[model samples]
Target: MALTFEFETEKVIQPWRTITSLDTTLLKNWAKQRLDDAHHYNMQSNMKERLKEDVLKQYVKSSEILISVANRHCESTVSGMFKSVLFILTSAEGIVLSVSGPQELVNTLNRNHNLGPGSVFTIQNAGLNAISISIELMDWVYLTGAEHDFKLFKEWDCFCSPVRQNGEIIGYLDMSFSVQEDHLLLAGLFAFTLKSIEEELGKQDQQKSIYEHFQTYRLSPREKEIGYFWLKNYGALRIASELGLTEGTVRNVVKKIYRKTEVSDKGQFIRKFLNGLI
Candidate 1:
C-alpha cells in the first residue's frame, strides 16, 4: 500500500498578476514529455469503457459517502447558484471517482475533456487541471482560461481544493466553469465545501474502527454467508440469488443480523457491518 513518488522542484510561490508569469512552465514541460498525440487521442476515445474497471473500485466502499455528499452539493449549486458549474471528484492520485452537473454541462465536458470516472488528471497525462494542480501545490488553486497549457481547456476556468482526512490529503474536489463565471467566489465556496467533507470523513473514520471491532464477533453459518455479501455492499435480492436462497429468506436472515448486532435499520446495519461494528 505504500507507494513512493517524487515531485519536481517547482517554486512554491504563486503568481497573481499575469497569466504568462505563472509558475507552471515546468508542468507544461512535464506534460509534453510524458505523453504524445496518440496517448491523448486514446484516452479521449476510450474513457467511457475504461471507467467500468478502474483501480479505485476497491476504495469505493469508503468513498461512497464522499461521492454522495459531493453530488448533493453539486446538484444544489447547479440548480440555482451556478448554472454552468460542473463538479468533479478525484482520488489522491488524481483518478476521477465521480462527476456531476446539469446534463448539458456534463455532456459538454464529456465531449471536450473526456470527463468521466476513471479518467486521470495529472501533469503526466492531461496538462494543468485544477485537481492535479491542487494536489501538487498542496493548496487551493484557480486556473483561468489562458493560464492552462492545454488548448482543449483554453476557454475554461477551474477552482480546485484538496480533501483531507487525519491531516493527510485523500482526494480533490474541483469546480469548473466558463471564463465569465466568478472564479474567486467559486474557489472560496470550494474551500468551504472541502472543510465540510473533511469533517464528515473524520466521523467516518471513527465509525470504521467501531465496525472493525464488530467483525470479531461470532455468527452462525447462514448469518456469516449473508454477512459476507453485506460487507461487499450487495443488495438483499442479489445476495439471495448468489447464495441460492429466496429474497424472503435473505430478509429474514438480515432481520436476525440486525437483532444480533443491535442495529435497528439497514443504514445502521450496513454502516456498522462495513465498518466492522457487527
Candidate 2:
C-alpha cells in the first residue's frame, strides 16, 4: 500500500536518534499525520489470513538467526520487565516469522487478533501500526494507545525497530504490551535490544567470512580446526582439552597449520590470513 507524507526536508530522518530530541507536540503531530492519512485511505483495521504453511516456513528458515536472537533477548531481558509481553519478529515485507513471550498472551493474540506466524502487518493488511510504520520509515517507531490508527490496537503500546543486515532492512523486531505508564522507557529498552541483535549478527558475519577465507589455504579439516582456535588465542592445552586430543597432537597440528599458511606465530598468522576478512 502507498501512503505518502510531506516532510520539511528531502533528507531521510533517523527517528531513533531524534526521538529524545523531539518534543511531545512534534511527536504527536507526526503520528497524527500518519493516522490521518491512514484514515483517509480507509485502511483495513483487521489483519487478513496468514500465509500458507510452506511459505511461512521458508520465511522462518531464512530468518533463523534473527528469530533466535530476538527470542533470546525477550526471554533474558524483556520478559523480566512485564508479566505479559509480546515480541514479534517479521520479515521485511512485514509477515510474522515468530512470536515470543507468554504462551497464554500469544495464544490470545493469535486467536483474537490474527497475530501468529505468517500474519501480515503491512499497511494494507493491518492498518497504521508500529510494524507497518517502521517498515515504511525504515527506522524505529513507537505507537501508544489512541495513536494507533486501528481501534483494535488502541490498547497496545508497541515499539518496533527495523532489523538491518549489511545496511539493508531484513525484518522488524517489535515489543508490545498493554498500555502502561513507562512506555517511553520501554521504547529505549527496545532500542537496546535491537542494537544487541544487530551486533551479534555482525559478529557472525565476520566469523563466516573468516571461515571462507581459510579455504584458500588448502589445509586439512584438522589443521583448520586447530588453526581457528589458535588464532582466537586458545592455548595448546585448552584446544586439546576442548577437542579431546593430547596437547602434543594439538601443537603438532598447529605447527603444520602455521607452516601451511606461511606464518610462524599467531600474530603473523592472523596478519596474513585475516588481513581483509575481519
Candidate 3:
C-alpha cells in the first residue's frame, strides 16, 4: 500500500524524479484533476470495449485475471528479485479488483480488504490518496479488509502508486522495504509492474469474455440448496431446523458454502448465486 507523502508539481520535469518527490502533497488538487483527466482518457481508450456497468460486479474476481498478469511480470522481469511485492487490482471505487504477491502478503491484504459484500469506496476510491494510499491499497481494503486504514501507511514504509489504464485507475503495484532510499527501485518496480497489470487486465477483459470468465465459480448441489433456502428469507436457525441439522453444523456448512461461492455475506451470496457479482 502507498502512503500519502506529499506531491510537488513545480519542482521537476524528469519522470523518475517527478514520481518520487518527497514533496508529494504540493501537487494535491492539480494531481487529482490530472487523475480525473487520466480517467477520461482511459474511458475514451476503452470506449470500444463492451461496458457492463449494470452487469459485471466491479472487482469481484478481477484478481483472477490481474494476478495472472502480475505473476508473469515478476517471473519474467524481476525473477523473484522482488523478494516481496504485492499487486492489488481494484475498481474505480476502491474495491479490490484482483490480488497477487507473496502468498502470506496476499492473504494479509485479503483479510484486511474484505472485498466481498456491502463494500463501499468503489473502484475510484483507489485513487483517493493517489500519491500515497495507492488505488490498489484502497481497493484491496475494500476487498480483503484492513487492520487499519490509511492511518498506518507511513509506519509500514511502503510506497504506493496508482496503476492506470488509458488514464483510468485500474489498480496498483506495491513494495514494502524499510529504507526510504529503496523507494527508488521499489518505485520503479511499481511503475513497470503497473503497466504490465494494466495491459493484462485489459487483455483478460477482452479475451476471456465476462460470462466465460465467471463460469469458474460453479456452485455445488448442497451449496446451491442451502443458498436458495437462505435467499428465500430463511435464517440459519430455520433453514437448519427444516433440513434436520443442528444450527452449529448448519452454520459451519454455511461458512464453507460462502467460501465456495466467494461471498462475504448472505446478501452477496444470494445476489451472485441468482444474478451475478456485477
lDDT of 3 by residue, 191-266 (tens): 6765676776665453334334334656455555566577666888998888888888778878887786678898
Question: Candidate 1: worst 10 consecutive residues by lDDT?
Answer: 41-50
lDDT of 2 by residue, 127-201 (tens): 667887788768788777676667677778888888887787888998888896577657666777888888888
lDDT of 1 at 236: 91
- TM-scores for every candidate against the unseen true structure: 0.60, 0.79, 0.38
Of the candidates numbered 2 and 3, which has the greater lDDT value?
Answer: 2
lDDT (Cα, 0-100) at 118 in candidate 1: 75
Candidate 1: tens digits of C-alpha lDDT, residues 152-240: 56667987777777788878888788898876667666666666778777767755564445456655767877866776678999999
Ranking by lDDT, best first?
2, 1, 3
Off by over 4 Å in 2: 1-46, 240-249
Clashes of each: 6, 0, 44
Ranking of models by TM-score: 2, 1, 3
**Cα miss at 60, model 3 (Å)?**
2.7
Model 3 / residue 238 / CA error / Å: 60
> What lDDT is reached at residue 61 by model 1?
59
Model 3 stretches with alpha carbons more than 4 Å out: 1-58, 61-67, 74-79, 109-151, 159-169, 179-181, 198-278
